[model samples]
Target: MKKILLVCSAGMSTSMLVKKMQETAVKEGKDYEIEALALSEAESKIDDVNVILLGPQVRFQKPQVEKVAGGRVPVDVIDMQQYGMMDGESVLKHAESLME
Candidate 1:
């Protein structure tokens, strides 16, 4: 199974995205673990994840998250338009590409 981590300012809104990602993963029969957390908690969550996705509001923190990720995982910022529109398929595709 693959692990994907999402980081945001407070983690609340991003949890919704986590749900969508989960649903997409289930529909595709993909084996994966996805979780969302506040930026403050990101350091502890980085170790085992394969990818790190940042919420638009937290885009400024990408460098920090990447530093902690230390090349072990690919880190990216989720598309704001997709995120605001709640486009699960697009987000899922983005996540899948990271694994590839």
Candidate 2:
């Protein structure tokens, strides 16, 4: 299964988003291993994921994460509107596009 990592300040809110994204993926018959983590833990976990999505609150950390990713994994921020709405499908679509 492909892996998607979502990171935020403390990983709490992103956990809810992860559950929603997983539900959407299953409904679409796609099997993906999605997870949420605190930015502090993201660096240790970055190498294992295909893409990294930063929560709007933590979007400023993008360059740091990208540095750790070393061009191997795509890094982006979840759209502020979509993230505020917890729109999993849209975020998943964005992640899918990045993975492709």
Candidate 3:
């Protein structure tokens, strides 16, 4: 299963997104291990993830996350509009594209 990590200021907001993504993944017959974590927890979890998606609220931390990830995993920010709308399919697609 592909591992996707969603990071935000406190990990709380992304939890809802995680659920939506999982629902979409199931509906689309995609296999994935998705989870959310606070920015503070990213370093410890980076090694185990295939892709890192930053919540828009934490987009400023992208460079720091990338640095910590050391180019080992792809890091990108979720589109603001999609994120705000909680469009799981689009976010999942974004993750899928990054995995490519």
Candidate 4:
């Protein structure tokens, strides 16, 4: 199973996207572990994740997160439009592609 982590300013804001992503995964028969966390809590959670996706609001922190990730995981910023629209399928596909 792949562990995909989404990070935003407050963590709370990504819950809906997480839900949508989870639903998409289930429908596609993917057993991925999807989750979201506040930027403040991301570092601690990064260790176990296979990929880390940043919310548009927190995209600027990608460098910092990558530093913490230290090449152990792939980190990327979600597309602003996709995030704004809460398009979970796109984001989930993006995450999977990164893992691949």
In order, candidate lDDTs are 0.90, 0.95, 0.95, 0.94
What does the lDDT come to for candidate 4?
0.94
lDDT of 3 by residue, 1-100 (tens): 8999999999999999999999999999999999999999888999999999999999999999999999999999999999999999999999999999
Q: List the residue pairs that clash in candidate 2.
A: none
Q: Write down the RMSD of all candidates, one decimal each.
A: 0.8, 0.5, 0.6, 0.6
Better model by TM-score: candidate 1 vs candidate 3? 3
Clashes of each: 0, 0, 0, 0
Q: How does each model score on TM-score?
A: 0.96, 0.98, 0.98, 0.97
Worst 10 residues of 3 by lDDT: 40-49
**Per-residue lDDT of model 2, residues 1-99, tens digit only:** 899999999999999899999999999999999999999989998889999999999988899889999999999999999999999999999999999
| Residue pairs clashing, model 1 | none
**Model 4 lDDT tens row, 62-98:** 9999999999999999999989899999999999999
Candidate 1, TM-score vs. the true structure? 0.96
The true-versus-predicted C-alpha distance at residue 55 of model 3, in Å, is: 0.4
Worst 10 residues of 4 by lDDT: 39-48
